[model samples]
Target: MILQLKEVNGMEEGERTALLAIAMNLVIFGIKYVSASATGSIALKAEAFHTLADFVASLTVFTGLKIAKRKTKSFPYGLYKIENLMSVIISLVILYTGYEIILDVINTDLTELRNSGFAIFSLLIATFLTFWFSNYERKIGHKINSPILLADSSHIRIDVLSNLIVLLVVVASLFGFHFDKIAALIVVIFIVKTGIQILMDGIRVLLDASVDYETLSKVEKIILDTPQIIKLKTLTGRNSGRYKFIEADIVLKTHNLDRAHFIAERVERITKEEIKNIDQVQIHYEPLQKEEIIYVLPLTEDKTSISPHFGEAPCFMLVTFKSGTETASKTEILTNPYANIQKGKGILAAELIVKNMVDFVLVKNGFESKGPHYVFSDANIELV
Candidate 1:
C-alpha cells in the first residue's frame, strides 16, 4: 500500500497492465478453445475451460480498473476498493470455469478423450506461460503493494495449476483408467476453495476491517512522538485507498488555549512528517490543570571607567536594590544612578518580575535573573 497504487501515476500504469493482461487472455482463450474443440480431448477441454475462466477474469479486472479509477460526484472518496471487488468476481469466474470443465468431462465420450496429445502439449505450453506471467506480476505487485495486481497474479497462479491438472488428466486418460472426470472434479474443488477465500478477503476490506497489529503500533508511536503531547488517550484510524486517515485525542499539562492550539498544530505537522502514506490527520486537544505562575521583576545596572593620573586598572562600583516583600509591588523594575557622576560608561538596566507569591518572589534581577529584585551590583566612571 505504501509504494504502490497510492499515487496517480502508479495507478495509471497498473490499470494499463491490467487491460493488457485481459486482451492477452482473450487471444489465448480463443486459440485454445478452437484447438480443444477440434481435438475432442477431455484434458484439452479442461484447459479450454481454464482459458475461458481467464477471459472472464480479465474482463472483470478491466471493469474493475475502470471503476476503481472513477471519481464519483456522490462518493467523494475514489472508487479504488472496486478493484478488490472485481478480484472477487474473477475468483467466482474461476470457480465457474472449473465447474464447467467437470460437467463437460462427465457428459462427453470417454473414447474421444484418448487422442488429446496435441491438446496436452498445448496445455503444457499454457502452463509455462501462465506460470511465468504470474511470477512477474507477483514481483511487481509486491513492489507496489497493489492488491489488484496481486489478485491478478493469483489468478495466473491458479491458471498454472489448472493447466497442470489438465496435463495430468490427459496422461492418466492415456494410461487406461477413465480418471479424467475425477481430475476435473478436483479442479472444480480447488477453484471453489480459492473463490471462497478471495471473496471473504474482499468483503472484509469493504467492511472497513482493521489492519494488522504492526501498522497500529507504528501509528501509535508516531502519535506519541508529536510535540508537546503529554499523553495520547485514544487513536482511531481508517484507510480509503493508499492514504490512512487518523483521529487522535491528546492531552497536555497546559491550560492556555493558545498553547494548546500551538501544540495541536505542531502535533499535526510532526505526525504527517513522521508517518508515511498518511493523507489526513485530525488531532483533538485536552488541557491538563496546573497552577497559574506569575513573574517578578528586579532592578540592576553595570558600568566601567578608566582613570589616567592614578593609573588605576579601572574604577568599579556596586549598588543593590532589594524588594522587601515576598511579592514585588510592581510588575517591572528600573535602575538609575543617584548622581550622573563624570559619565564615562554609565548605563541603566531593567528586569521584570518572573515569580510572585505571598512569601517570596522570583525576579529577573539583572545579569542572569538572580532573585526577587533587581540588584544594581556595580558601576564605574572614567576621567580625562
Candidate 2:
C-alpha cells in the first residue's frame, strides 16, 4: 500500500514541478522581452530568448509527462522515459537558441542603449526569481528522483548566471564600458553550458542507467529487515525518469517450499514499502539447508533391541512381511525411522542407522527379555 502511494506521489510531484516551471518561465520571459525591447540591449535580448527556451522546455516537460502517464498496447512498460527523451530534445533546442543568440549579437549594430537603468532593476529581480525557482525545482527533483525536473533546474541555474552577467553589463553601462555585444557573448556561453549538462543527464537516463547508491542502500536495508530472511544476495535497480524498477535475490534457511515462498514475498513487499521511489519489485528465492541430512535404517521386530550394523541410531524403520515365513517372504519397510513400534508383532530384526553415537533407555524392562538378538535375515536393506 505504501508502495502504491509512493509511486503516485512521485508522479504527482513531477507534474506539479513541470507546471510550476512553465508558469514561472512564461512570466520571466515576458518581463525580459519587454525590458530588452525597451532598452535595445543585446544582453537583455539574449536573456529573453533564454527565458523563452525555458518556457518551451517546461512545456515539453508537461507534454512528455502527460504522454508518459498513458499506457498503450504497444508499450506495456508505461511511458515514463518519454520525459527523459523530451529533456534531451529540449537541451538541443536550447543549445541552438544559444547559438542563434550569439550569431545575432555578432551581426547586429547597437546605435543606443535605452532605459538601461530600468533594465538593471528588472534583471536583478529576474536573477532573484531564477535562483528561487532553480532551488525549488532541484528540491522537488531530488525528492521524486525526477530526471525531467532535474534537467529543468539545470537550465534555470544557467538563467541565474546569465542574469548576473547581464547585471554586470548594466553596471558597466552606467560607468563607461557599455559593450552590450560582449555581455551577449557571455550569455551564449551560459546557455551552452546549461544545455550540455541537461543533455548529458537526459542521455544517461535514456540509456537506462541504474539508480544511485543512496537509493540502492535503502532498498537493501528493507530486504534485510524482512522476517525469516537469512541473507540478501543481490539487489539491482534501474530508473526511467520518474519510475524505478528493482530486482533482488534472497536466501532463506527454509527447506520447506511453502515457507520459502512466503518469506520471499514478504521481502518483496517490505522492500517496496520502505523505499519511496520503486514502482516494481521482483524477488528470487534461494533455499538454504538448516543442517545436513542424517540417514537411518529400519529393523525387524524381533531384532528391535540390537544396534544396526552401520553405527548408532539416527533413526529407525519398521518393516512388515507376508504370513507363513519366519524369514519374512516379502519386504515392506519404512525409510523415515524416527517412529515407535509396539511389541507382540511378528518378530524381526530392527537396524538403527546413525549419524553419531546415541543411546535410548528401554521402556517397561521389555529390552532385557528381547536380548541382543541380531537376526541376519535375507531381506533388502533400505536406509531412512
Using lDDT as the measure, the top candidate is 2
Backbone steric clashes in candidate 1, count? 14
Q: Lowest-scoring 10 consecutive residues by lDDT in candidate 1?
A: 375-384
Shift of residue 92 alpha carbon in model 1, Å: 2.8
155-236: candidate 1 lDDT, tens digit per residue: 7677777677767777776777556666667777777777777777777667777655665677678766443455788887
Model 2 lDDT per residue over 165-270, tens place: 8888878887767778888888888778878888887898888888889988988887765534556888888887677888888876555677677766776677
lDDT of each: 0.59, 0.70
Model 1 spans > 4 angstroms off: 1-6, 241-243, 253-277, 290-384
Error of 1 at 369 (Å): 19
